[model samples]
Target: MFKGLAVLLVFQLTGEIIAFGSHLPIPGPVLGMILLIVCLRFRTSGRLVEDIERTSSGLLSNLGLFFVPAGVGIMAMVQTVQSEGIKIGFILIASTFLTLIVSVWIFIQTRKVVERHRETQ
Candidate 1:
């Protein structure tokens, strides 16, 4: 478990370094997750994969705890949020629905394409 956690952290650190060095738009942790996925896909060691799976499961089991810091930070900015709350809330809600609609549309289109390909085959 400890080794798996260390490996994860190392990947995250590597990602942070790359992001900082390249000035990428994506977050370091997100890049790290991408790196981890690529590594997992190419890896042949079952033991390592199992360890990572176990570690991931443990972290996800208590994922809510990770949100505490964000919640606290939001509390710290309560005054700012309150002043712009309506505008912020509106944007968030609108963007969320738009994203959902766009995602569903893309999924439907992709499914149709796949179906056509299957039929042709």
Candidate 2:
């Protein structure tokens, strides 16, 4: 577990250093995750990778716990939320429906292309 943690932190630190030095807009942790993915793909059969995978799986299984702080922070801002509740609610609803419509359209188009390709094959 300690070794796995050390590996994770090392990648994160490397990402942070790169992001800070290059002044990239992306977050260090995000870049670190990408680096970790590439490393994992390269060493898929390694015992160390298996350990890391186990550790990551355990953390992800309890990922909902990580959102508690954000939920509490939102609760703390209840008054602000109340004041702009309607606008916020409208935006959320609109964006959700818009996303659904776009997703369905894209899925239909993709399915059509796949069906056409199958016919050609």
Candidate 3:
């Protein structure tokens, strides 16, 4: 498990470095995930894949714990929110809605491209 985790981290770091060096708009971790898929598609390593899956599952299982800090930070900002509550609420709602729209747009675009590729293939 540890070995697989290490390998995943290494590849993630490599992708992140490439993304950084090339000035990619996407985050490094996102690129790393893509790279992981590419690697999986090309390689035939059952044990390694299994290990990676196990490690990923473990990480995901405790994902809520990871958000604790964010929750804490929000709690710590109670006073600020209390002061600018209305404006903050409006801004958060607007930004969240905009993010959702953009994400949906990107998902639709990607789905279209994938469907086209599948049709051609």
Instruction: Report backbone clashes per prediction.
Output: 0, 0, 0
lDDT score of model 1? 0.94
Candidate 2 lDDT over 37-98, as tens digits, reads: 99888887977887787778877999999999989998999999999999999999999999
At residue 97, candidate 3 shows an lDDT of 100
* Clash pairs (backbone) in predicted model 3: none
Clashes of 3: 0
Best by lDDT: 1
Q: What is the C-alpha RMSD of each candidate to the true structure, in Å?
A: 3.0, 4.8, 2.8
What are the runs in model 1 whose C-alpha is more than 4 Å off? 98-121
Instruction: Report lDDT per candidate.
Output: 0.94, 0.90, 0.92
Query: Sorted on lDDT, highest at the top, how do the candidates line up?
Result: 1, 3, 2
lDDT by residue for model 1 over 53-98, one digit each (tens)?
8899999999999999999999999999999999999999999999
Window of ten residues with lowest summed lDDT in model 1: 44-53
